[model samples]
Target: MAWLLVLQGCAGWQSALDPKGPAAGELAWLIWFFTGLCAVVWVLVMVALVAPLMMRSPARSEPLALDAGAEHRKVRLVVTAVGVTALILVGLTLLSFFANRTLAAIGSDAALTIRVTGHQWWWEVRYEAAQPSRILTTANEIHIPAGEPVRLVLTSTDVIHSFWVPSIAGKLDLIPGYVNVLDIKADKPGVYRGQCAEFCGAQHANMGTFIIAEPRPQFDGWLNDQLRAAAAPTSADAKAGADLFLKRACVMCHRIGGTVAGGTVAPDLTHIASRQTLAAGTLTMSRGNLAAWIADPQGIKPGSHMPVVDLDGDELNAIVAYLEGLK
Candidate 1:
C-alpha cells in the first residue's frame, strides 16, 4: 500500500517520474536503472550477511579454530566485493558523463531561444527574434511550440532561484549576476506547472509558473496576439477605467505596450488579461482577483516588490476594469 502511494505520487503533472519530454524521460530512466541496480546489490549483500548464520557451526571442542582454507575464501570474497563496488562506481560515473553529454546536445540545434530572467519571485519570459518587431515579452506564463527544442538562457536579478518543471526537465539554478543555459522540449501539447525549487525568500511557495506547449501554428498565433498592443477602450466604463489607471500611481511599476504608462520595474501588463494567473500564479486571473491583487499585493504575495496602491472603491473598480480589458 505504501509503495502504491509512492508510485501514485510519481504520476502527477509535476512529477519527475512522469516524464513528458525527452530530457525528463532520460532522467527517469537513469533514476529507475540506478535504483534497480542498487536494489540488486542490497539483496546480494543481505544474502551474504545471512549465509554465515545459515552455515553449520563447529563444536566447542574445536576450540574456535579458524580454518586456513576458510580464511583464504574470506579474503578472496572481500577483494571480489571491493572490486565489484569499484567497477559499479566507475560504471555509474561514466553513465552520468554520457547522460550529461546527451542532455547538452539536446538543445544544440534548437531553433528558438528564450531569455528567462528570474525576478524576486516572478519570471520575465522574453522571446527575442532577429527583427525588432518580432520580439515579445511576457510574465510568469510561457507558451512554446510542441515537439521542438527551446534553449532557455536563465539568470536572476536578486537571490538564488531554481527553475524546475519536473515533467519537462530537471531543475537548474538561477544564480544572481550570472547566467545558465538550459534546453527543454515538450513531446505534446499540455500545461506543465513549475515552481522555484530553491529556497529564495518569503512567499517562495507562491512563486509559480506554467509552461504551455501547443502546436506550432497555435503557438505562433499566441505570440502574434501577445505582440499586439492592448486594444482601445470600446465602452465608457473601460475608457474611464483606463484614464484613472494612467493618472494614478499604477504607472510606476507596470507598463502597457500601447499606452504611455511605461514602467520597467515590474511585470509587463500589456496583455495581462490574457494571462491565466495573477500575482505569479497565486490567484486565477479574473476581475475580482485582479482587483484584490491591485488593491493589496502584499496580501497575495508577501515580501513582493509590488507596493500597495491605495484606491477608493470606485478607483479600484476602474483600475481593475481597465486591466481586465488588456486582453
Candidate 2:
C-alpha cells in the first residue's frame, strides 16, 4: 500500500502543481478547479441516482393516473438540472476566456525576447537583442532572469514540436513557417525541466530542454560568458583534435566562434562544453559521452539528423578533447 502511494505524486520539478511562475500558477489553479468541480458534480450525480433507487417503492402492476405533485417535482428537478448544467458551461467558458487573457497579459510587456527554433531532435535557443553583437545563441539550455517575464518566439524548422515546461507555463506548438509567442516568468531561481510534447520522430521522447532561472547579475554574467568565443585548445591532443575537426566534415554542420568552422545547419559549438547536456538532452556533457556522440550518433539516438562522422580512435579522442576545451 505504501509503495502504491507514490501514485499520489511528489510534486516534482516537472509537475504542474509545483508551479514556479505566474503562468504555471494560473494553469495549476485551472486544473485543480476543473478537477474539483467535476468530482463534486460526479458525486452529486451518483447520490441523485442512488437516492431515487433507494426511495423508489415496489412497482405497481396496474398503473394509475400520475400524481400532479410528483409530476411537478419531476419537472422542477429536470429544470434545475438543466439550469445548473447551463451555469456550469457558461462559467467554464468565461473562466477559459479570462485565463487566456491573463496568460496573454503576462507576455504583453515582455522585457526579454528569446527566439526558440525547433529542429529534428534539438532546440536552437537565441537571445534576441537590438545590437547584432549582443545576439547570443545556444542550444537545449535556456537562461532567463527571475521575476521578469520572457517572451519566447517559437517556430520549427522541420516538423511540428510542442514546447512544454509544466512548472513554468503550458505547452505551445512550434509549427513550421508559423510563429507562436509564449510568455514565462519565474518567481525564484530554479532549474525547470522541459520536453518536446509533440511527436516528431524516433527520438522525440528524448528531446528535452532546461530553463535555468537566476538572479539578474548572475544571468548577465552568464550571458557575457556565453557571448565569448570558444576557448583556444592549449594541450597537444586538443590542438591536434582542433585541426582534425576543421579538416574533417564536422566543420560543415557545426559552428565554432573565432574559428573557420562556421555552419548554420547545426547547433553552435562556441560554448558546447559549457552546456549541461549533449544532443538536445539525450546525454549529459562528459568526455565519454562527447566521444561516443561524435563517433556514432545513430547508435545513441536512432533517426538523429546528425550523421556518423568517420574518425579513428586517436582522432576521436583528440576531437573530444578539443570540444571539451571549448568552454
Candidate 3:
C-alpha cells in the first residue's frame, strides 16, 4: 500500500501528459473532475460534522438551537434544495461526459491496419493490405510510422488475450476468430512497452512486446526491407552459419527473408538481427542474449512453444552467427 501510494504520487494529476492508452486523456479529465468534487464534498461534510461543537452556546448545556420560525424553515428548505440540486447536477454532468466521449473514442477509426494475433506466449503480427492482397508476417515486435493513425485489429489464436501499450493505447481484448479494432497514434518517434494484459497460460508472465513507432521515411524503409527475403551471407563463416541454421530444426518453425525457412509457427526471422530485442521483447537484442536464448529457450521463457533444442558449442555459435547475419 505504501508503494502504491508512492506510485500514485509519482503519477500526479498532470502525469496524463504521458498517456499511452486511448481513454487516457478523457479519464484524466474525469480524475480531475472527481478530485475537485471530492474536495468540495469533504470540506462540506467536515464542516457539517463539527458545526454543533463549534457553534455551541455558552448559556446552554445542549448544542445551539435554531429559531422555530417560518423564515428559518424557508431558509433550511432552500439550502437543502440547493444541495440536492448540486448533487443531481453532478450526476448528470458525469453521465454526459461518460456516455458521449468514451464510446466515441473507442470506436474512432485511423489509418494503417496491423493485425495482432495472440498466441500462447507470443504475438503474431501481420501488416494487412500493404499491397494488393499482400500480408507481411512477423512476431513480437510491432513497428508503426509515427505521426500517423494506426488501427489495430486484435485477435487470439487459442485463448483470450489483451493488448496494452502504456505509451500508445489502452487495453483491448483479443478473442478467437473475432477482430477487435483499436485505434492508436504516437506524437513522436519512440519505443513503447506493451504487454498481454490478460493471463493466458504458464508463460503469460513473459508474454510482452514493444511498439517501435518511427518517423515515416524510416518506417517505410524498414518495412520495405522486411518485406524482402533474407540475403545470402557474404563471409565464409556467415555462410557456414546460414547452412547450419537450415540444416538444423530452425527452419521448421521460423521464416527468413529470401530463404526456404518459411514456417508459420514462430516469428519471421527475416530481419531478426535488426531488431532491438529478442525472445518476444524479453531481452535487449544482443549476441550474448541471443546465444543464451537459442541454447535454452525454455529456461528463459518457460512453457514457450519453442522447445529446447540442445546445441553444442559449434552449432550454437553457428546459429547465433547466422541469426545475427540476418540483417
Q: Best candidate per TM-score, number?
A: 2
- Candidate 2 per-residue lDDT, tens place, 136-228, comes to 989988999999999999999999999998899999999999999999998888778888999999989878888889999999999999999
Candidate order by lDDT, decreasing, is 2, 1, 3
Q: What clash count does candidate 1 reach?
A: 0
TM-score of each model, paired residue for residue? 0.94, 0.94, 0.80
Candidate 1 vs. truth: CA RMSD?
A: 4.0
lDDT tens per residue, model 3, 1-327: 212222232222223446644455555455567778778867877876797578754574554565469468768966996887698687958766774566356536565799999998889999987475357888888888877778888998899999987556557899998989877776677766677889898978677777777889999898888877787787776788888888878899988867888888888898888876677666667889899899888888888888777788987887788788887
Candidate 1 global TM-score: 0.94
Residue 248 C-alpha lDDT in model 2: 90
Clashing pairs in 3: 20-167, 20-168, 20-169, 21-169, 229-257, 229-258, 230-257, 230-258
Score each candidate by Cα lDDT: 0.86, 0.89, 0.76
True-structure RMSD, every candidate: 4.0, 3.9, 5.4
Output the number of the lDDT-best candidate. Answer: 2
Residue lDDT tens for model 1, 233-326: 8777788889988887768888899999998778999999998887677787778878888888887788999898777998788777778889
